[model samples]
Target: MVTPEEIARVPKVLLHDHLDGGVRPETVADIAERTGHQLPVDDPAELGQWFADAATSGSLVRYLETFEHTVGVMQTHDDLVRVARECVEDLADDGVLYAEVRWAPEQHLREGLTLTDTVDAVREGFEQGVAEAARRGKVVHPRQILTAMRHQARSLEIAELAVSYRDRGVVGFDIAGAEAGYPPTRHLDAFEYLHRENAHFTIHAGEAFGLPSIWQAIQWCGADRLGHGVRIIDDVDTSDPDSPRLGRLAAYVRDKRIPLELCPSSNVQTGAAPSIAEHPIGTLAALGFRVTINTDNRLMSQTSMSREMSLLVDAFGYDLDDLRWFTVNAMKSSFLPFDERLALIQDAIKPGYAI
Candidate 1:
């Protein structure tokens, strides 16, 4: 059995975490008061519980409504920086050594900051958080992934912004929103542009939707990964262990080595998967798909990388080796340069698990 303490000490890599979705409850309260945004609950603890409860609506769109308050408070340059800084600190405290925190810059323009300024502000915050973590004898290498809202028209513009900041702390790009109606094909131009620039990106597909979403994300848009690709299980026939078979889409995902960023708690909260035990991640992992676990929305899901792993351990009986495998898969699938990814796995992740 993998103890919670051991899981806490294990170095992990996170590929699909949201920036606005992981703000500290106390910080949300403070920002709400300072920014004049009224939250449902005044106390930080109750506010956090409110978010977790509100997200339990079992609809992805409804679950996202909880972000209104969090995003409402995050409008100014200072607010963005503070949220970004705290994101790193919180993930570092949870034993995440490497994380890609994603958000939509266009959403933060309410206070008049330009998209470029928003990315720059977040970069500064990440640097500050890294320094602070180092001072506290922890090492967390954080990267940013600029996400374009799929239901909106700013994807091409957001894609351009992401490519412009590639050499900086920005590592990759993504499209996130209600995945059912707004398919990845809606932003074909953005994905094409990203491909032409050799930029990496992931699409939020096969979560609230089904195989068609996953197919388009891979076949049409050329996504490097599938965010919450839990719905890929729909195409998998696992009734018989001896005769298990995968549909064409699932086979392609596994044979092509595409990474599936599976967020178990968020999947349950959004009704993508029934429960941790029934999550497709177990089947995908057993059958050799490059499955990586993530915390899609920490506040809404009320989870961390540790908690996600712990849930899987409790449900699937995964040991340290399984945890290490998922961490390495996430590190390998990360948009970081290959050399850096290799070093983190060899020097950091492997050693941490060896303990």
Candidate 2:
């Protein structure tokens, strides 16, 4: 049996965590108080529970409402830095060795900070957090993925920003928000720009929406990965458990080995999945799809990497090897260079999971 303690000790790689959605509730309350941003509850514990409860409303739109408070307090450079730093610290404590923390820079510009300033502040915070974690004997490598809101018109701008900072801390670009009306093809220019520049990007598709959204993301926009791609299960026929059939789109996704960033807890909270036990990850993984586990919103879902893995262990009876496979899948699908990715898998991930 794989214990939760064992899950916590193994190294993990995260590819779908949100910077704003993972803010510590205590930090949110403290910053909210100092910045004069009103929160529903002033106490940290109550605020945390409030976020968890509100996010469980079973609608993605309503689930996203919890972010207003977290993003509200993170207006200035200092607040951004603090939140980003604590994000790394929390991930490190949860045994995450490498992560790509994403946020929309445009949303943080309300406090007179430019997109460039937001990127720089987050980079500085990541550096500080890495150093602090190292001092405590925890080594973590954190990178940035600049996201543009799908409802907004600044994806091209955010893509350019991500490319400009490629040599720094930024690793990729993404577009996230309500995925219903705002299809991935809505930002074709940004995708084309990213492709031309040889940059990597992931699209948040097949979550709130269905196959049409995912098809546009891959077929039209050419995403390197699928965020919350749980809906790809729609294209798969599981009537015959002995031999399931895959549709064209599903087979193409699997044949090309496009990674699916699956967040079980967050998906259930947002009604993307009925429950962790019924998540598509088990079916997808069994069928040899490149599926990676993630925590979409740590605060809203009240989850960690260890918790996510533990849930899978209970639901699907996955063992250490299964956990290592998921970790390697995430590392391979990361935006890091091939050599660095291989090095982490060899030096850190493999050794950590070794019996």
Best by lDDT: 2
Structural RMSD, model 1: 0.8
Model 1 score (lDDT): 0.93
> For model 1, which pairs clash?
none
Per-prediction TM-score to the true structure, in the order listed: 0.99, 0.99
lDDT of 2 by residue, 98-213 (tens): 99999999999888999999999999999999999998999899999999999999999999999999999999999999998898888999999999999999999999898998
Which pairs clash in model 2?
A: none
Q: How close is candidate 1 to the true structure, as a TM-score?
A: 0.99
For candidate 2, the 10 contiguous residues with the lowest summed lDDT are: 65-74
What ranges in model 2 sit over 4 Å off?
none
Q: Write the per-residue lDDT of candidate 1 for residues 1-355, one digit (tens) a residue.
A: 9999999999999999999999989999999988789999989999999999999888998998998998898888898899999999998899999999999998999889999989999998999899989999999999999999998999999999999999998899999989877889999999999999999999999999999999999999999999988888888898897777999999999999999999999999999988889888888899999999999999988899999999999999999999999999999999999999999999999999997
Candidate lDDT scores, in order, read 0.93, 0.95
